[model samples]
Target: MLYQPDTYKIEQDLSRFGRTGNDTFIPGATEEGLRQYRRLLRNNINNTMVQAFPISRQVLPDDEWNELINLFFANHDAKTTQIWKLPAEFVTFVKEKDYATLWGKPWLNDLLYFEWIEIEVYTMPDIEAEPFTLQGDIRNGTIVVNLEYRLIPLRYPVHLYAVEEAKNHPGDYFMMVYRHPETREVLFADLSALDTFTFENIAHEQLSLSDIAAGLKLQFALSDQHPLLINMIAFVQEMMAQKLFLGYAVERKEQF
Candidate 1:
């Protein structure tokens, strides 16, 4: 009887070969061929990471970045089959391993997240928008916003400042990332604490301008509402111009 290796063991060894450059388990595989295969796989992963995180690549020194990628390749068992999603795993790996603290870059996680959001927004599946009207009384109607959007709160102002500068100015930073409806381009806007709170309410709740103004007045102890409503209407108009605000949600009439 001929000797045959277990198929499952062979599969495991093949995976190990990619990570460790070891080819001893295969019957006829050459060390040189396995080395080439490993190099090719690693290079593909490196390229993907580079494309996804250009900012992180620029910030880290060549040696450190190379070492980090190598560590990730060897240590992490990626769950995603799509190569484009490997960077997302890399971000998780970095956070799990506390690479930022090890490398003395406190803003590293925020930087990685900021860069990743652009890719995420660009590649996210399309969302169907509800019926809306471009011309309506925004204050009276339920204001509609772009469905494909994300709000991220970071400890560092990485969106506004360079990594080095961001480290020094660590505080609460809110970023609004969205895709333009017509352009389909991922865009980012910085928000104040108040703006972030207000935008969150608008996105999650069916709040008209009057409702928002009333809530703000109650929350902030404001005596006047006219100026606040005026400013908010102007803000909504600006957002509509940017395609972030998709006018107001259309109210359907009841059937007889």
Candidate 2:
């Protein structure tokens, strides 16, 4: 399109310039002006990627990070008009590129996703908490995890800023991230393997504290006085204070 002499092909020229390097000369546009234009585009994209994946930026070397950004800008086709969501597009690009094999940074994408989720949570629309009343006692009612929260079962503890700490831990790292309705603050909660199990399988509108404890003992051989149980209770109290509890149902639903 740049080689085409038709002045009417403005969109075509611009599109070509956006994808590859510019190969056209506008009537009055200086070469320096064109160079700055490309530079601005790259800088804008790089800035957003940095914003989207701050931790990833810190871990990756300059050459590799710049290459990844350039690769996405040149090849990845963005389907959305929302430029703020480009890093999300980069996630898709990484998966498609087989980033684990190609770049050998399997944990990098996990970190990117972790950081991206924080951005997503911050940008989520505000929701009013439904009117809720405790069923006589705060710890006895059904425990309902808020819909605004994300139960991310990650392979690495990307929440850890220290890369060595993230690297040493191996398996599924369970985390609960929620945005408070009133304060609009994004909060992080860690879930132990037992807590993760209970949240994944046992906690519901039908379950009470006793019910959860019973299920935990039956399934995981955890006794009533287990440290995990004690810690889990404390975690729930914290979550309630943070409004991630979403209050609770007054009457536990019939299991039959």
Candidate 3:
């Protein structure tokens, strides 16, 4: 139905209820109305948040989760008309406020951020790409990594902290979230420091694999008086197989 006077009033009432949980101003709205609205809205909003931040949700207790939901409903006045984005707004709200009272989990926000980015990567639109060759000279030819990839150097191993192995092991980590161009499937890689160094060199501008290897050796890719060419080659091959390395370009030599 289009926004008529009565419907507009009802919308206003619900908006108010969304932020206050009180519907006394709503004409003929009873306590039952408040109860039902609160339940439905809270459930839907919480579900969205969970879908966006699954790791964080699983770690929180029921009461703590409910508090987080209530806090968002009462505090957030979202700018987006789209309900799908409420979870992101909730994350923003948490960033501004102190949710430590709910739990002393210091890693919660970082984990939430990582999980949220997975959803974002999954839903992000793929751009039209020109055809390219994945096989080329790694030593000199320009290389192109997939445009769909984001190299997130996370402060925590939030990508794998849900597992038991990462329980005791913690350090600087890179969470590589990307989507396959052909399949549209979202994939993630918890990269090593060396992998991060190599990945940083592949760009849309096209840097050669050898140049990347050289840069790494000059900076940190060396091991016991020699550059780790073997490791670099293996990593490059894996990335190519995984479709992370789109292809390479050989610039023609200038004619005199």
Candidate 4:
């Protein structure tokens, strides 16, 4: 009689094989065949994780890296169906388990997040920009920032410095990650306190350069608006050149 295994049991066994390289005992499956299947599954995950976190791989030793990833593979139930998005769950797992402390790498979480965000911004779905004019008075017109962007705060300057060096300088660091409009490549920009504030407001609110300057003045306690406005205009112009700013927002004419 040909033995038939429960379909659900087969699925559970396959999942366990992928996670722990355990043997699958289905009928007609040889020990060597099960080993090869397990090896293939493990290798696929290993390759994906390495591609996703190259920097972290470089920083951690072989044993530590293997242990860390193995733990995650065995423990975390990944939610994303997309393989590219699996790295995101790895980041969450590291943070939740406080792996930074376990590994004695205080900046591990920030570095993981910094690297993962680049992947996220690069792979994120395209966002359609609203109607805007390329040539307009930015000072008075509402600004249109690129929708495919992310603003993140870090405790270490992992993006700017090497992992080892970054650990020495622990402080608040802000970064802007955005996809280049034409090339579709992800780029990073370090932000100062004031720059972070300006970018955040522009991204969230439909504000003009003048409005941004006013808010900056109040936030930074500046009495002189002339120089601030001049600087803000220059900043907006630079951002537009980089494709970070689509342009000034324009009113869409309604058709009856």
Candidate 5:
């Protein structure tokens, strides 16, 4: 077999690019090779643009389009003054900086992450907690929330845009994303219905499902015919099958 210098050089360039741990294009790389590498890099970046920048749907002029792509995927070097090796640059940036805001409006990064969480919650081999109906004297004034649940705060609220009533408006909002032991999917609940005091009450385990229903009497009903009740039952069964629900809510008096 003939030794191919071209193939050898390509591999050498790749190895140099990979092992160097720097964003500068592999040294000794020719302009022609660099152009081919950059073309491929740009193609990959274009595919990522939709999720990264939904706003890119608008047609852009060639120069601006190229500039945004470069800013996202390329790293500049002051010495040789070349921009290349986007994968390395992207990885470095993701690790070193909060680069998520480039995708859209300021808070969209957390929205995207929250959206991704549902997929992640659905697919994991471990079973997720399902919604369950409260039993044994879940009455008016009972405050209900998951005992082991976590708020999972972002720097800003990402769920505000999701509220149908707030469709025309934009502001900060926190979400109570939870998975009861029996449910296969995560649930997203807006925390804005409750006052800051109520939110604090839930965190302190001072509220019960019964109490929450009374507080928002019209929003949710406690009857067995309620949609939430049916969903909770089915979810509880699923969680039991998966061993995901432990059925722990704060005991009313114990909450105080």
Candidate 6:
């Protein structure tokens, strides 16, 4: 009966505004009511913590729990029920600079952000075409590729760590994150090796597939039937089929 939706609303409201706002009518009654209300409100608040973040409860002492819960609920509003549906707030709390001192990890957010990106790339919609490699004159500046098939850009290195471990030491990295349309397998690669400039030139309708392939051959100094050329083509086909290649990006030329 106490946990009914309406009762829940009342309790939540008491937890939220019972201490802050003034009650005009029944001033003595309001003050007395607030005393009883805070007890129930604290219980309900702890229930939410039990449900949403059990780990915090297990690891934190009772005194610490109050601070942690209060910190999370400090800005909450009771009238709107939407806040209850929010994901566990511990992750955000632990990542904050102030909280990081408590958690003993400052880079936690960066690591989490990096891991989240991989989850994004793995779930990206299927790209129809497969990866295609070229061996034409790239060094001699003859290679061409679809601009759209250009290099993948990443602000953080998603490949260095698995989804879970990356949440500790996130760093900047750019590389391919590919997926095969049919098999749904993923791939990774370096942008420089794939020639990002050629990929972009092709993406923006700047070059034809044939011309691009020819350019690759020229740039890489390969003959029409070179073994290396054939291998390159096969590699592209595999990358495309499995969606192994992700995205391309240009490196900081000045870094060298």
Candidate number with greatest lDDT: 1
**TM-score for each predicted model, relative to the true structure:** 0.92, 0.79, 0.80, 0.89, 0.40, 0.36
Give the per-residue lDDT of model 2 (tens digit) for 1-256: 3455566566556655655564975667677867777788888889999988888899989999988888888888778788887777888788678775587676776777777788778786665544466444544556655667777878878786466577677687887887877777888887878667666543444456666666667877765535555666776677777777766655547898
Q: Rank the candidates by TM-score, best first.
A: 1, 4, 3, 2, 5, 6
Angstrom error of the Cα, residue 60, model 1: value is 0.5
Clashes of each: 0, 0, 2, 0, 17, 40
Model 2 residue 204 CA deviation (Å) reads: 5.8
What's model 3's lDDT at 201?
64
Q: For candidate 5, lDDT tens digit of each residue in 4-60?
A: 987677666664443332344455867676666656755756555534334322433
Please give the CA lDDT of all the candidate structures: 0.85, 0.72, 0.71, 0.85, 0.45, 0.47
* Runs off by more than 4 Å, candidate 5: 1-32, 45-69, 75-134, 139-170, 178-183, 193-256
Tens digits of per-residue lDDT for model 3, 1-256: 5889988988887877866676356777677867787778777887888778776777778788878888888877777787776666776787677573345555556676677677777777776444577667766666666777667766556677563344355578888888887898888887788777777766643555666666666776465423565676677778878877777754556999
Candidate 2 overall lDDT versus native: 0.72
- The candidate with the higher TM-score, 1 or 6, is 1
Q: Once model 2 is optimally superposed onto the true structure by TM-score, how far is the C-alpha of residue 96 displaced, in angstroms?
A: 2.8
Instruction: Write the number of the candidate with greater TM-score, choosing between 1 and 2.
Output: 1
**Better by lDDT, candidate 6 or 5:** 6
Clashing pairs in 4: none
Native-to-model Cα distance after best TM-score fit, residue 73 in candidate 2, in Å = 1.1
- What is candidate 4's lDDT per residue for 1-256, written digit by digit as tens? 3446587777678778768875567766677777887788777777888999999999999998898878888888878888789999999999999989987899999999998999999989999878788978878888888899998999989998898999999999998899998899998888777677667777887777689888777978989777978877777788788888898788787999
**Candidate 1: misplaced stretches above 4 Å?**
1-5, 22-25
Model 1 root-mean-square deviation: 2.6
- Residue 31 lDDT, candidate 2, scale 0-100: 74
The 10 consecutive residues of candidate 4 with the worst lDDT sum are 1-10
Q: Lowest summed lDDT over 10 consecutive residues: which window, candidate 5?
A: 78-87
- List pairs with backbone clashes in candidate 2: none
